[model samples]
Target: MIQLYNVYKTYNNTPALVDISFIIKKGAFVFVTGPSGAGKSTLLKLLYRWENYDRGQVLVNGTNVGKIKFNRLWKLRRKIGVVFQDYKLLQRKTILENVAFVLEIVGADKKTIRFKAWEALKNVGLSHKKDAYPMELSGGEQQRVAIARALVNNPKILLADEPTGNLDPELASEILHLFEQANNEGTTVVFATHSQIILQEGNHAVITLKQGKIVDTRVVV
Candidate 1:
């Protein structure tokens, strides 16, 4: 459902991605793995048009993302979800409102938004935290809130960047399992991380990058 062809991205004369090419099919759970400065995060940014390519094309579900108009880009983003290590929730909003933000932007009805948000929170095991503000939650709980927010919109693809970076191993494993569950339910999952524990999980299409180029591609069997 996602394809990148001869893509390149650069910043201040230094290349971040060099002529990268790859395809991710629908419903596939993939991991973009690499050491620091290997371009894993750069590639993820390009997927959502957060970073535009300096060369070549990025196609999402048959549409050239580079050519999508700004207004249309906003609409296109609704079809994809992103989870960041920082948890990006509104500090002042309750968990329910945070997850409901996505639906609100798309003009979903109040009843529908509340229902979907609650379901997503339940999926991430954060139902009881629904009325709590972000600052009142633990790190893992905050991250779960972020995940619930991302899933509430029922996106076709979910991109997570260092999702477990700040959590303990036990919490990290829990988050990984949450991602696995999302993949099982048909949301194409792409995660970027340098965690060794994540690399050992052994159930994903792994892509490794080195110095701005893809150095390895392996399907964990």
Candidate 2:
């Protein structure tokens, strides 16, 4: 579903990504693992269109991402769900409202919005915290809410960047399991993290990077 060919991204003549190329098939779970400043986040930014590459092609679901206009990019974004390590929730918005925001933007009816938001929260095991503000919840809870917000619309691909960085081992494991469950349900999952705790699951394709280049890539059976 996602392909990058000879991709090169530079800023102020300094390289962030250099000649990176890879293909992620539909219904697959993959990792973009790398150390700090290794362009892992830069790679994700390109996928989310936060930044554009200076050279090469990026295709998502057969559409050239580089050619997608801003207006059209919004539509493409609707098909993707992103979870950041920080959770990126609105401090003032209640948990329920946070998840409902997506539905509201897409013109979903109030009843459907509420139902879908609640279902997503339940999936993340945060049903009872629906009325609480983001600051009221613990870090793990906030991350779960973030996951719910990302999944509420049932996006085709879920992109997570260091999703478990701030949580304890147990919570991180739970979050990984949630990603696994989403993958099992056919939502293509692409995760970028340096956390070895998750690699033990041994059910994904891992692309290891060092200093902005792919050093090793292994597809697990």
Candidate 3:
């Protein structure tokens, strides 16, 4: 469902991704693994269109991502979900509001928005926290809120960058299990992390980067 062809990206003339190319089929779970500064995060940004490539093409379901118009960017983003280590929830909004806000932007009616938001929160085991503000939650709980917000719209692809970096081992494992469930339910997952624990736990496709180049690609057995 996603393909890149001869992709190149640079920052101030320093290459962040060099001739990167890959194809991720629908319903596949892929791990993007690399050390610090290995360009793993950069690659995800390019795929998500947060960082536009300087050259070549990025195609998602056959549409060129790099060339998407700003007015239509929302169309592209609505099909993808992103989870971050920082748990970028709106600090002042209640958990339900935070997740429902995305649906609101998409113009869904109030009843449907509330239903989907609650369902997503329940999926991440955070339904009870819906009425609480973000500051009142623990780190793991906050991250779960973030995940719910991402999944509320039922995105086709989920991109997570260092999603478990700040949580404890138990919580990290829980988070991974949630991601596994999402993948099993047909959301193509691209998770980028340097966590050795994550590397060891998941048996799936792995794409390893080094110094802005893809050094290894592990096909699922």
1-221, model 2: which lDDT tens digit per residue?
99999999988988888888999999899988988889888998899798999999998888888888888888879889999999999988999999999889888999999999999999999999899999999999999999999999999999999999999989999999999999999999999999887876646899888877788998977
Candidate 2, poorest ten consecutive residues by summed lDDT: 195-204
lDDT for model 3: 0.91
**TM-score for all predictions?**
0.97, 0.98, 0.98
In model 3, where do residues sit more than 4 Å from their true spots?
none
The global C-alpha lDDT for each of the candidates, from Candidate 1 onward, is 0.91, 0.91, 0.91
**Per-residue error (Å), model 3, residue 11:** 0.3
Residue 87 miss distance in model 1 (angstroms): 0.8
Q: What is the C-alpha RMSD of each candidate to the true structure, in Å?
A: 1.0, 0.9, 0.9
**Tens-digit lDDT track for model 3 on 1-221?**
99999999988999889999999999999999998888988888877788899998899977899998878888889999999989999998999999999999889999999899999999998888789999999999998988888888889999999999999989998999889999999999999988888878988899999999999999997
lDDT tens per residue, model 1, 1-221: 99999999999999999989999999998999999999988899888989898999999878899898877898679889999999999987899999998899999999999899999999998898899999999999999999988888889999999999999999999999999998999999999988979878747889999989999998855
